[model samples]
Target: MPSSPPNPQLAKRYISYTVDDIARLFGIHRHTVREWIKRGLPVIDKQRPLLVQGADLAEFLRKRRDARKQSCAPGQLFCLRCRVPREPAGWQVVYRPLTATQGTLNGLCGTCSARMCRRVSLAKLTAAAGNLAITTTQAGEHIDECPTPIVNRDFKEG
Candidate 1:
C-alpha cells in the first residue's frame, strides 16, 4: 500500500484569527464570515483557548475561490453582432421616470451608458413600427411606410 504525503499548505498556526482575518484569508467580506457563523457552519473548537480548525477555513476558501473564478466580471456587455465585448459608437442616456418627464444626460460614454433616446429622422420624432420610413403627406398626415431600396447584386455564375 502507498502512503499519501502530508499537505504542507494545511499547516496549523498558533494564531487566533478574528472575523476580519477569516474574511481576508478567504477573500470574502467580514459580514460574510459573520453570516456563516450565524448559519451554523461547524466550529472546530469552542474551548477555553479558542481556535479554528485549518480544515474548515480551507474548505470555505476553496468553495469561494471556485465560485469567483467561474463568475463573470461586473459591467461586461456581450456584443450581439461580434459575439464579444461591444463598444456602441453612438448612444444616449435618459432618465424616464414614471411620474415625470424624461431627463437627458450629456457627455456619457455610449458604450457603458444607459439607452434612452428619441430616435429621430428628417426633423421628426420616429414612432415605433416594423423598420419603416416616415413621410408627411401634403395634408400633414404622418405616413409610416418602409422605403424599398433596390439591391444591385453582382453574382458570379459558376
Candidate 2:
C-alpha cells in the first residue's frame, strides 16, 4: 500500500526569518516585531535574535496585517523617523540592519527612529529598576560588622 504524503502545512516550515522579512510581510516596523517579542509574544524564541520562524510570521501577519495599511509607491522606503514611506533622499537613506546577515533594513522616518531609540533606552531603565537594591551602607555602618572580632587569638608576649 502507498503511504500518504506529508501535509503542506508541515512541509518543511521555515525555521527562521529576518526582522525585515517579518516587517515587510506583516506591514509593521522591525522594532515593533522586537517589541512584541519582548512583551512575551508566543512567536519569539530568542535562543538568538533577528531570526523568527515561518510559523510565527504567519500567525502575526494573519492577526495584524489587515488592520494596518500603507500607500507607498514602489521602490520607496518607509522612514521610521517620519512614519511614512518616501523615495530615498540624500540624508534619509540610512540603512540600519538589525543583523549583518539580514542585509539592509527598510528606513523609517527620523521621528520614528528617535522614538525607537527612546523606547530602547526606557526599556534599559526599566530593567535596571528590577535589579535595584537598598542597603544601609549610605548610613555609614556596615551590616556585616560585629562588636567582637570574627578571628581573635589570645597571644602572650614572650
Candidate 3:
C-alpha cells in the first residue's frame, strides 16, 4: 500500500516519541517500530526508554519512502513485476493516449519479459520516441496483445 503524505501539523506538535508512541501514531506493530530503529532511525538512548526525535523520525521515514520511488528515462518504462525501470525488448514501445495531455506507454521487459507500462505526458512522447522506436495506437488497438506469455513460478513455503 502507498503511504500518505507526511502531516506537517502532527510533525510540529511532538518533539519526541517512544517506541509505543510511534507504533500507535502510525497504527503499526511495536515490532515494526523496533525494526525502524534497526533500519537506522536515530534515537536518544541515554534514558530508560529510547526516544525517537520527531525531526529525525520524519526525515528517516521521508527518505525511506522516497527511496522506493523509481523514475524512467525517455526510452524506458517501469516494470511492476520486476520493480525496476527497463527498456523494451526490441527498443520498441506502443503508446495509447488517455487524454489530450496524458498517455500510457506499453512494452515488454527486455529481461523478465513482463508487460510494462508507464504514464507519461503527450509533450514528452516526441522526446521519448526520439530515444526509442515507438508505435502510436488507439486505446483499444493492442490492449490484449502480449509479446510473451507470463509464466507463473511457484514458491516453496519455508
Candidate 4:
C-alpha cells in the first residue's frame, strides 16, 4: 500500500496518463493503478496501455479526500473513538482557555462517553456552545505571579 494519499495537484489537467505514468507519479504500484481503474476511475478507452485523463484522476482523488472528512455542526464535538460529531453528555460543556483569544470546549460524548473537545476562538465560543450550558474554567496563574513555583512554568524554588 502507498504510504500516503496521492496529491490531486500532481495531475496536469490537460494531459493523459498511462497506467505506468500514473503509478510513477503517485509512487504506487502499476497494478494498484489498474485497481483504481477497476474501482471507477475513468479511462480513455479499452486499449492495451490504459489511458486516464489527468482531470478525471484529479477529480476522483479530490472526491475521495473530501469523503473522509467529518465536520461538526454548531453544537457538536467530534468524537475520536466514534468517528462522528456528537452532542456532549448532559448538555454541558467546559471551556478552558489556552490563550487570551482562544480556548477548548471539553465534554463527554453523549453516545460513547469518550472525551471530546474542540478548539474555538473566544469570540465564537458562544456560537460554538449553541444550546449547551457552558462553564468557563480559569487558567492557572503564571509562575512569576504565583507565590509557589507554577506547575508548568518551572520547578525553581520560590
TM-score of each: 0.27, 0.27, 0.51, 0.49
Better of 2 and 4 by TM-score: 4
Give the range of the ten consecutive residues with the poorest summed lDDT in model 2: 149-158
lDDT (C-alpha) at residue 129 in model 1: 14
For candidate 1, the C-alpha RMSD (Å) to the true structure equals 21.7
**Number of clashes recorded per candidate:** 0, 13, 0, 0
Candidate 3 residues 17-128, lDDT tens each? 9988876676566776776697688887768598988888888766645544656777887775665678888998888877778787888889899888877789888776
RMSD of each candidate relative to the true structure: 21.7, 24.4, 10.2, 13.6
lDDT values of the candidates? 0.33, 0.36, 0.68, 0.74
Please list the residue runs of candidate 3 whose C-alpha ends up more than 4 Å from where it truly belongs after superposition: 5-67, 142-158
What lDDT score is found at residue 50 in candidate 4? 78
Off by over 4 Å in 4: 1-68, 141-158
**Cα deviation of 37, candidate 3, in Å:** 20
Candidate 3 or 4, higher TM-score? Answer: 3
- Candidate 4 TM-score versus the reference: 0.49
lDDT of 4 at 122: 99
- List residue ranges in candidate 1 displaced over 4 A: 1-30, 39-41, 45-51, 71-158
